[model samples]
Target: MEVTGRRWLLLHADEPGNCPEPSTTPDDYMGGFCAFNFTSGPAAGKFCWDQQPDYSAFRESSFGHGILEVKNETHALWIWHRNQDLYSTAGDMIYIVRQPERCLVESEVP
Candidate 1:
């Protein structure tokens, strides 16, 4: 969530400036997660990741924003606000069904 130069490296290492891909295996432009070289700073062209399918499926279908609300002790809500509907128009509201359970706190957790 925190945007920084390192994040940018991971997001965009396959651009025209970085490593040139082989023509035999035409690279999928919009897929794959990447790893950053933490030890190196803005040295350029230093990242790695496994091959991934073209990410058209996730991109085309994503079209809504939602708010996460903790209603009460036993329930929460996720309401997706669609683009077509007005702000007042409740698009898709659902009770985010949950069951509370005990959690073990780490030594660092006060």
Candidate 2:
């Protein structure tokens, strides 16, 4: 994880993104764990504690695609490719900077 934004003053993560949401089927993480919290952006609410309500942010079984490079208007850069890895190749990348004057008053998030 890497977001150059006041939302997190620039973030970073090595893994544990958490996955296995309400799939409710197709071998959903053996049938359990799901916790995702990122409403808008910049790691919105930031979640993934223990896991149980909902999840979907892990990858490793191969086949992947998730890259966004705004590079402007606030700055952005995210990658997550696994399709054999070739186009630049990126198993995991991040870089999203956006500091809206340090805005984080979502009800003061308890």
RMSD of each: 15.1, 16.9
Candidate 2, residues 1-110: lDDT per residue as tens digits?
A: 45466554433232355333433324434433223334555444554333323335653798778979898756799988788877667888888765644432223346
lDDT (C-alpha, whole model) for all candidates: 0.50, 0.55
Clash totals in order: 0, 9
**C-alpha lDDT (0 to 100) for residue 88 of candidate 2:** 64
Residue 28, model 1, lDDT: 65
Give the clashing residue pairs of candidate 2, or none.
Answer: 1-13, 3-96, 4-96, 4-97, 5-98, 34-54, 34-55, 35-54, 35-55
**Which candidate has the highest TM-score of all?**
1
On a 0 to 1 TM-score scale, where does candidate 2 land against the true structure?
Answer: 0.27
Off by over 4 Å in 2: 1-58, 63-70, 83-99, 103-110
Q: Per-residue lDDT of 9-82 in model 1, one digit per residue for the tens?
A: 24354444544343333436633222233223343343432333354235435366888899886678888776
Q: Which candidate is the best by lDDT?
A: 2
Candidate 1 lDDT score at position 34: 29
